[model samples]
Target chain A: MTNFPDIASIRKDFPILNEVIGGKQLVYFDNAATTQKPRIVLDALSGYYEHYNANIHRGIHHLAEKATGAFEDTRRRMQKFINAPLSEEVIFTYGTTDSINLVAQSYGRKFLKEGDEIIISTMEHHSNIVPWQMLCEEKGCVLRVIPINDEGELLMDEYEKMLSGKTKIVSVVHASNALGTINPVSDIIKKAHKVGAKVLLDGAQASSHLFLDVQALDVDFYALSLHKIYGPTGMGILYGKKELLDAMPPYRGGGEMIKEVTFEKTTYNELPYKFEAGTPNIADVVAAKYALDYVDTLGKDNIAKYESELLKYATDAVREIPGLKIIGQAKDKVSVLSFVIEGMHHQDIAVILDNQGIAVRTGHHCTQPLMSRLGILGTTRASFAVYNTIEEIDSLIKGLHKAKKMLG
Target chain B: MTIKEAQDELIEDFELFDDWESKYEYIIDLGKQFPPLEEQFKTEENIIKGCQSRVWLNAYMDGELLKFEADSDAIIVRGLVSMLVKVLSGHTPEEIASADLYFMERIGLHQHLAQTRSNGLASMLKQMRTYGIAYQAAE
Candidate 1:
């Protein structure tokens, strides 16, 4: 057996795991949606709110200085988390949705011209698709989609053929939230760059599982949510190349983002502040540093290893259930296990599981297009994290049998 | 039963279960008991706006009373709608439009509803009231 983190000891860090749901112990298998916070992360949040609760930047007061320092400290931590070349390359946003929207507006809107192409995949969440669609509508640009195989793996050949000089932007998800497929992003970035197109990797799902190095991938932009990394919600990072961000226009207009105010013209602030408009989610940002530290303390490799074990157990156990079909069978996957029981509604499965205190997400999972492509409404998705165990998978298998017996 | 009486009865039924799981199972059973909404009525126009779940609520005036037919993609949401339907359907438009659904709180269901589910339930109630108001205006 591989050397992995102690699951029992690691589970102790998350107090929410001890919670009871529907008269049973909570079995949280919805990590892909958002992860439960560790005590350290929550304590960090409480520490900030209790001690230094004030607005960041431009305040001279002691509390303000303290808050600003704490807030900026998070940015530096995030920079190290992703191994970005410069700390200023990191721009905090509300979440992944906000980060992607920033890129779509600031980068896509300003640089992309008429008849240009933006290539995405069928597996992209609505957050990754809708913004570019809006941009396409405004800029008269064409949107191309990379097709996926039955296994939910992207067709690299089709993608290569689709790329041309007209393809100005190739935005793809680093890891699919619905499918759990870890895309070959480094290769995608290289190929896109070859066509003189910039690549934006939606790292919302990957950030928690993978150790990301922006310089190594040569990726132009990356968007991810910290909450999925066992951090706070409403705290996200948008890491862009310094030169690209310096050239792109500001996303939102607010006090902190502007360098000068005049009647005729306005100049935007430097690399990160230009994109960070309005009062950011400061307390959550501070909490995010602790979340990253928690992950660092445990080690991402250990988490991934344990989660992979859970996925293996789950996949094997679920497959044993007669008439249950697993969706997205890609070789390179995270811990998401999406499946549908024959002649059973996904909602029914979800309800049954919830009754057993096994929290699983059902329905399209914000990937309606992907569901449509699969010719199914949705599937019950049980995504595992480091805190989960084989016993939970056994419970899930038993729950599935009960659901089949009751509903069938 | 009258709308208030039906709501009170529901609260009483919910109290029988000591735990949320049994109560939830009972609710799902209630949902399952309801005849599925007719396919003809499940149109985009009938779909409730602001619902996280894809819930389609359709209503028509039956003489002086309004009859509501609804469905949801979520089983729990369907159960919630079934509860609403039991209370509001076959009631006078004025009664439905003015109804204060305190039974949810009394039944301990209000606290258990997820934010989205709460919003969905609110949207369902709003749609029911909108139909009531429309029927009243027509009269």
Candidate 2:
């Protein structure tokens, strides 16, 4: 039997759980969109501003030294968190979208040529899809999509067929944001490597749920948003192989990313800094360590066990409801439950649920292509986080029933 | 009735609900009761694309007054469309262009009008006003 963390105490760490909305207790089931911040993460954000609010990496003064140390410390923490060989492999970005764009612009423009094929899955978020499409439009590369089954699992055989000598890169989501399918990244990376194609995993949804080891997975690139992992918004990490990052050009040319600037010639900085331009999101980056620390304290294994139980409970309960069909039922999935009810619009369901103080993400969820592929306009998704409890899932079930009765 | 009178009637109707649940239930009922727009009128030209739901609105001049017929895939937005049609459908173009919609705020659904909500209500309102101005210019 797996030991789960005390749900009562975990809920207390997130103050927003106590919030009352529409005369009822708030049940936040929108974890996939963004997780609620813990008190420790919040304190870290404020503490940095209160104590050492100064420019990092440039200044030699006490506040600057302290701030820079704290900021760099997050990079090291992230390196260890994802098991990257070098701290320099972790490039801080605005978010996962920014990270993907960085790779698409820097790596794609530098290496990819005309008629080069890039493979992506139907389950990828718009962040992963649009950047490559933009690159393809510019570079004249062919974009191929790996289709999925009705159950939302990626077809491995079809993906194999799409691979060839022309395939330069294969970018796929590690875990689907709309559906909860935890993809087979190990096999995916190995297959891509066989064809001499680089692989980039959109780890935005997977980072919080799965244990990430970049070296073990042998992934060329992995992008994640810290906000979805119980950290502040506007901060993300892009893990690229050291050799690959060194070869790529800088994404944005600015102060931090530059080595020396002359009117005639300019030089770029090393490894991670080449991709990260500007002063960066210092406060959020510094505070993000605490969010990772929070996860560590809970033990990722314990958290995952509890969340899977929650997902199972929710799936079983919702399946019993008449005319409610689940969208994704993969054997392996994260703690996300997406479903569509007959004769009830997803937006209408969201409005009704919101009235009961139960928040579940409704509509296409930035996965319009995935929605279209599934022959659906959208689905009502309730994603669970570490802080969420079985009682909250019960409230969601109750709220959904109410929505059905009223809409019916 | 004038726009102000129509808005007042809606406000009075909303005032009957003691709780948000009842108010939403009434709104959903209004959505069901509202007639669907004609198949021909539900064209791409008439569609207002919101993030969550789509609203299709068609407007024409009935003599001097503007008549609006709208439908939405989402029930709540359809109810809001019904409310918009009730207040502005029978009014002159000049009156509609100048009319202030205060009923949504008075009825405690001003949040729906927020740009961030993206339920098509705000966009639909803009479309209605745009139609009013366009018809006035044409006249």
Best by lDDT: 2
Angstrom error of the Cα, residue B3, model 2: value is: 0.4
> Model 2: which residue pairs collide?
none
DockQ of each two-chain model = 0.30, 0.89
Predicted candidate 1 versus true structure: per-residue lDDT over B33-122, tens digit per residue: 877899999998998743235678989888888999998766666888889899999998989888888888888777434455423667
TM-score for chain A, prediction 2? 0.99
TM-score of 1: 0.92
Chain B TM-scores per candidate, in order, are 0.91, 0.97
DockQ of 1: 0.30
Off by over 4 Å in 1: A1-3, A60-63, B11-29, B49-54, B71-80, B111-121
Binned by DockQ into CAPRI classes (incorrect, acceptable, medium, high), candidate 2 is high
Best by DockQ: 2
Instruction: List candidate 2 stretches off by more than 4 Å.
Output: A1-3, B115-117
Error of 2 at A220 (Å): 0.4
